[model samples]
Target: MAFTRRGILLGMGAAGGLIAAWALTPRQFAPPLHPGEGEYAFDAWLKIGKDGVVSVAVPDLEMGQGITTLIPQIVAMELGADWRQMAVEPAPVSGAYGNPVLAARWSQLWLPMLSGLADAPDGLLTRRMAENDAFVVTADGTSLAAHELAARAAAAGARAVLAQAAAAKWGVEWEECEAQDGFILHGRKRLPFAALLDAAADYSPPDPPVLRAMAPQERAADMPPGAQLHFVRLDLPSKVDGSHTFASDVRLPDMVHAAIRHGPIGAVRLGTFDAARAKGMPGFIKTVAGPHWLAAVADNWWSAEQALARIAPQFAVGDRADSKAIGAALRKALRSGAADRVATVGDPDTWLKSKFDHVALYTIAPALHAGVETASATARFENGRLELWAASQAPQALRLAAAAALDLAPGDVTFYPVAAGGSFDARLDSDHALEAALIAKDVGRPVQLTWSRWQEHLAGRPRAPSQAVLSARTAPDGSLVALGLRLAMPSSTRELGGRLFDQRSGKDALFLQSSSDRLAGEGLIPPYGIANLKIEHVPVEIGLPTTRMRGNSHAIGAFLVETFIDELAQRARREPLSYRMTMLAGDQRLAACLQRAATLAQWGGGGAGSGQGLACWKMQLDDRIGRIAVVASARRDDRGLRVDTLTAVVDIGRIVNVDIARQQIEGGLLFGMGLASGSSTSYAGGLPTTSRLGMLGLPQLADCPEVLVDFIEAGGEPFDPGELGAVVAPPAIANALFSAGSVRLHHLPLTAEQA
Candidate 1:
């Protein structure tokens, strides 16, 4: 029999203080089973047992992104386990799953791109962006910068170092202090890591943990003993048949379901619902309200949904006027002078005067993350306590929000997280689970509230659409002299009050300062080295509540940047490849990737019916380089243009497993393009027009071009570029479409006509 434990569920009212103590009880944990704890259970587990599994905590959701498979491998490799004998479970609610050293390293090559958008003199911020690719050292906010954490890991090698010390004192060489099966061992004499756990926990980690990269001699041996990166090959019985679990399907004796509808955005409406009417209904128990009205204690979800539909709200948009009207207001907001200037390199107006012969005002649009599954959460208030099961990308955020709303201390609420269907970027803004908790708490009953597809489409966070204006001019020699760009729209994340980009300081503030060396504003100039170049962001907040879609909003920004570069190349009568190399005179890796992608795509060998386009990017994060090249191809038919296939060549240093890394790059391509696919998101009212996957204009799989990915590992150095979420794919396809034809597409998602 399998058992799960929950302590301190309730307490007597007479001894009210006892309830408080129970609510605040120290969290229970099941540490990783020592190699001897079991002739059964897992092969390995690590660090925090608060999650009851052998895996690292995940900060983001596992939506379609393959993080579920990738993150566990990192810790398992470090923890010394045969991952094949281990299981990947989402850690409870912790931030330990993050590896800033690697993440910050990848950020260097990218942050510079965002920094170049600053309106500073001579692209001063461009240099900062390049310098702090992973994170800003002195910037404010949550320090969610993964790079800073990397420094801590390296500096705090305290745990590893102590283990080495203990081994050294035991008369064995530190090198012989092999961390085996979570034990510091010397021949037959071994000490379980748990024996030293208490000692290791007290010491402060390194100021900047001195991380020793896994030596080349050690990496091949580091594959968790019997572990091979072939788990993906062992087909799961669930996948091929498309089987999955939705949180609403849970069954408990006397368990019930619910369907909740939230008030329109920004304005909360509390209504005087009729309990008498609902009492007569089959599944109705009672209705209550805190944030929104909820009809709780349902016999069945269907009956509850029916009673909910009958309830009427007594409130309307006051001062905050209309939800529908917000869209229109956003468009007008774009034209308002309140727009902030995010980036300004040179005197763009003066540069345009001397260099640009003409300018093209291209319209770049906004988008959304319409994950196939709608949001859902189930909560039950049994005996003065609350228990919740939810599918949330940010479990910690959701848990905190629920505790705050319920006036319950965070520990009073027990959150049981379910496997998420998908949490594209914006899934972090959790209103779904909180609402469900409120309803269940009100009636003292268990309720599982699910949003309708339409409700999700309108209420869920939609990626804000944007617009950009580009100007390009050529000198008599056909050398590109000036490229001036402006984001006609605003950013979802505001620029920090510092010199470059500022990260929002949340729970992980201090964690981000570690990797500030690789930052942004490096340069907008490609290898061609034209004298004047500029890119600017004109900030315009829609005032409507928005959520992050995935990776960073910068994901879409790369597409715009790459597409514009392609256009500049075409206008100058230069191969995009040659044009990029000239711009990257000082960037050998980027130049090399550009050459590699072109070669793989057979750039110049195209026939009349088929065409190819190329794009390159450099992520100079944490003093490491993660360069990528995108080569896309398509065929022109009498009926319409069709993308036949795409090929991506990436150099994410120290390719842990070529197969897994290849899968990630390929997955990024699909996700990056899905936004504009004809079947998915639609942009209207200066926002994503639709938040329904069925509605977003993404093309079908039949319409999806075949993709082939190849990796050129930068060995000797072990650098992981797991942050490829929003960077390479879109720019690659956009460039390919631009190559297939003369017209340039500045807006995403690339439309068929644009192709």
Candidate 2:
């Protein structure tokens, strides 16, 4: 059963003292995965079929992240199964698959009063909360961290039971039999898994199954450029052949298309509309109105969109949001606002009281996700039950929201997860799912709701605008002695937590915004060894609700810290690479990455007119830390600024799938490049001035730079490489522009003029 805060609180009132004890106790849930007729269920993570195919259950979303393949690959390698026999299915929401890592990281959102007690993955409170809520969210790059050990243990157990069955048939010791290549072998006597599945079902595996000597790792030498891979991605062929199913690809009998128009940002309600204008339009069914939006249903998507346009529904806006107001609020807060210390080392207040060597202000405009496919969902309501097919980063949240919108019990809603074309964390919001359910209920049939590109920007929340004043006291050698940062922005992460965990509206959540949010200040602490450093958050509400984007706060924090350091190096007449290396004495991994990246890019000392710049970053979640260094080459031609190449060296410790990791780094660089070039929007009277993707100045194929990526073979715990490249690219490119054109750009996208 799904747990809601209100329901839990009410239960606490009735159960009284027992509720507190019960809340801390661990909860057990039935396995979310069920085997088909010919399959034998081994555990919650995997099942073996009579045909010898091993299907692994993945609890994360597959949004071009290769997670569907990565998890199964882990199971295959650990179970000693052949790669050719591996398959994957999306696991349903259940306590068995709760993501304790993410739940612990986001403890403040769900357990705000006692977040400190539940801030670790293995903590009793964190496990209980995660399992009770089925918090299987697929954000923050925690897929492997949360599920790796569990999946490995499950696979090891399955392998042991299978070996037991094979040994029993051969009258040999189970420990002597080895399972490999989809078969159990003992002195050349072999038996396929299919032959022992029936007997294995009755056997119990060892309490602590023996694991393999090593986890899955691919040497960099084994995957040279253009070399064939041993285990190819299973989803690539279907995607290339156009047979893969995304949320929008789902179709149901007697389904109608819907196009919605949401009011601009602020407190708004749906107003009157000219329904007569679209009454006689071809295939136009009817218009449905909700509190804050309007939708038109028709036989086709194009027709529905046209109907919405023809009707031109209006909305009553109150306290509209404006870009000028947002900027002014940030500036005001930076000048005189209540500051809460996020991170501190030594005594920064005392150091900042004296004169600092350097100070600079950096600004980042609000950016959009600009995903390839807009928000789309297919929902059908009938027989007092709702069936939803959608691609979501938080599927349980989406299901709960849909059920609440329909005033039905949570058990009445069934969700089917599907692939997203590209989310960039956009799928975390469940507004579209709730809208689809409402539309389906109104139409009394299966309804497919798709927001047009225009409507997407109108309704979608953008990344919060930020302004930071960075002050640093440096030594004669350009090494930083102390640093202080005062960042002004909304408590965006807390706002998201309110919406995702508390099911509160955006405006309501913003109303409860606090003056401090550590999640928003992530990555602000430099990896270098600075004696005295302080980072303070000055939260400000700009009458605009912001949500989490791909890189989270690291993208903004890295740009601020790295660029300021580069500027300090230039002012002190020191080489950027050597200057940074001097401060990184404690972090050998980061220093190695910097050295390798500089070598790969052919370091030129970043002399004026050399067209090369350097930046590095580290992302840490719990014990896992991912480090990356980037060297960007850029120059301004007669046309405009052109980035010619980006060379990056990443150290994400152990590599599960080298090819996938490389793809993530390459994609992240380009994604970051896109943000650096454009992807920002300005609000005027609650409407974004930039409406379409073409207007966002996204990098086209011809604009893509030559990306070179390499990984360090440091065998340790694996880290997600998805956000590291993005976090470092903007500052690297900005520093490159400084070298190429002798201009200091303090704003993101390196605009010609500061806003």
Candidate 3:
């Protein structure tokens, strides 16, 4: 049986509601691993594979997102076992491998609307209410997210089952033989998990074990930490080998190397080729319809690439929309754009007519997603089935797409993942996987399409270049009375493949689909106290759209909101830090973050060559708050301005790893700065300018700055940190530019004039 929900609401990360539609189950006692052996499954399974080693099958792609690191910790916490002795596996694709929390948050349009503080909106209340039923909890169901709830439920339930099995064997009451530390204990007699497994190997499994909910009051009194506990240790190492295998390091028997002369225009392909020129070349394969005029099948890649150099790629360029024409069109679209009411306040018409303060004009820069690893996928069609070796962040989507395209059952396709060189928000969606499948069909063997540095720059998914305008009206009391904001961003719906949202479905009985009514989110606004405020979002369609660049819309929105606050401080002749704190009167975390970042960056002191500045933001997802301070160091060189050091402070509530989280935050700042400074991508028509990495002028090791990361790891709450990398950089850097250059730069990719 199968159930479907077209579109679903989403929260922060993907959690419950997605189940793998595995066809394998214990009919009598055991089943094989695969088709003939038994059946194929995509279930999130925790197996103690006879070796006494615990392995959990998770579905998310590692792509340097820390999913592998975090999921097992949650499992360890719940299983009450060894965290260091467990192994993490990328669970197979099916209903079980889906990240449902991702679906729910997507349903909510990935809104980062500061939910932890007071005066939360109705939508949050509704979501929290939904969490209780869908999540694991006794009363009002939703407290912790689905993953956390699942761990506790699975652990507690399994304990009860073990206790019953022991009771049956010893002829005692289940309660009398209480389960303790992954074992059954009765009056000092104990049975370890492995021993119990051996004893009950042939028994039929019972309904998920019964468990008495640990209420708040009974936790300390009924069970102390040391009173009875068994901790799980994960069994895994860093898996490090000094020698590495990148996409560039691939080689296999009968494998062929290919080079593409890409389409000069968007939505166009290579229609013709120069085969006659390559007829005399060795190792030359037939010229295909695409960019590769001729593929060279050889024992190695170098020989093929060398032979390919002799062949000329036929230039059959299609209708071209030059960069100039595209930029003009988008700008014109912005000029006469219709205003939308994203935020409302006490009649903005009254405030616009009676504004007592000055106006603030700000513009953001266009940035590219120069992820270290370019798009690469290898596919092979063998026997009656197909196998794929891909490095993808959205692996589940790739599996579904490949199956649909190849006319094969989802099970017919197998996805093998490799360690990601690194992903900086560019691996979300594309026809790359599809393209790999296409080439492999023609070659009739495994083919690896490794994008060169140039190809990645020219065809890579770049962050949509965006712009914002801020206008503020102030009262005599030095407070913002009315504010107006107009922003532009790429259409978010383009990613959903025109699918509609449907929340009500029987997916829980089928593939564990999370119920959410939204699939695409756009135009998000936070609660800012200002009278007569008007905010609107324009669906600006520039060239190649890449919305999944790390922080998504939250990153862009934070930049605009935070920068406008800085503009207000300058206008009011108040310190930027103090001014922002005033706006966040009731928010202690936000207020504290602003203070901390300023204090760390020495906000009031003279900067490297300029002066001090402060920047801060509160992410709606997971209630993440971060602050930034940058001291720009620029010398009189013939070149443009360069920064010396960038410092940041963050408070992500409950952190799982201080080291990993800090590294990400610091890296994110540099990533953001790289875009702000050197990187470049643009729109040539409705299509985005996919610049290759080599052409992007993004920062390299030569220009890297010193970054310091400080964290506020509050022990009171347990929550995942929300988008930390790029959130604090813009505000902090913009402030630095203001101090160093005294220009209050509005646009990003800060020009020599702005810098």
**1-755 per-residue lDDT for model 2 (tens digits):** 11111111101112111011111243434546666767776566887888999999999999998999999999999898999999988999877778889998888788888889989888778887777888889999999988887787778777887899899988999999998989989998999988887777567666555778898778876886577987789889889999999989999999999999999888899998988899899999998899999999999999999998999999999888898998999999999999878889998888888798899998899999899888999999999999999999998898888888899999999999999999988889989889999999989999999988888888888888999999988777777888998899888888888888788987788864554677888867788888999998888888888888888888988899999999889899999999999989999999999999999999999999999998999998888889999999987666556789999999998899989999999999998988888889899888999889998878899989999999998877889988888888988998998998657888987666552
Best by TM-score: 2
The TM-scores of all predictions, comma-separated, are 0.71, 0.96, 0.76
Supply the TM-score for candidate 2.
Answer: 0.96
lDDT, residue 93, candidate 2: 84
lDDT by residue (212-326, candidate 3, tens digit) is 4431111112232233422222221343543444444555567665554455434454555556666656666654444422344433445455555665454454445355654
| RMSD of candidates 1 onward, in order | 10.2, 5.5, 9.1
Kindly report which residue stretches of model 2 are placed more than 4 angstroms away from their true locations once superposed: 1-27
| Model 1 lDDT per residue over 586-605, tens place | 76666777777778777873
The C-alpha stretches of model 1 lying farther than 4 A from their native spots are: 1-61, 64-72, 94-253, 263-297, 306-349, 353-355, 494-530, 605-609, 620-625, 635-641, 679-692, 715-726, 738-743, 752-755
CA shift of 280, model 1, Å? 6.5
Model 1 residue 163 CA deviation in Å: 9.4
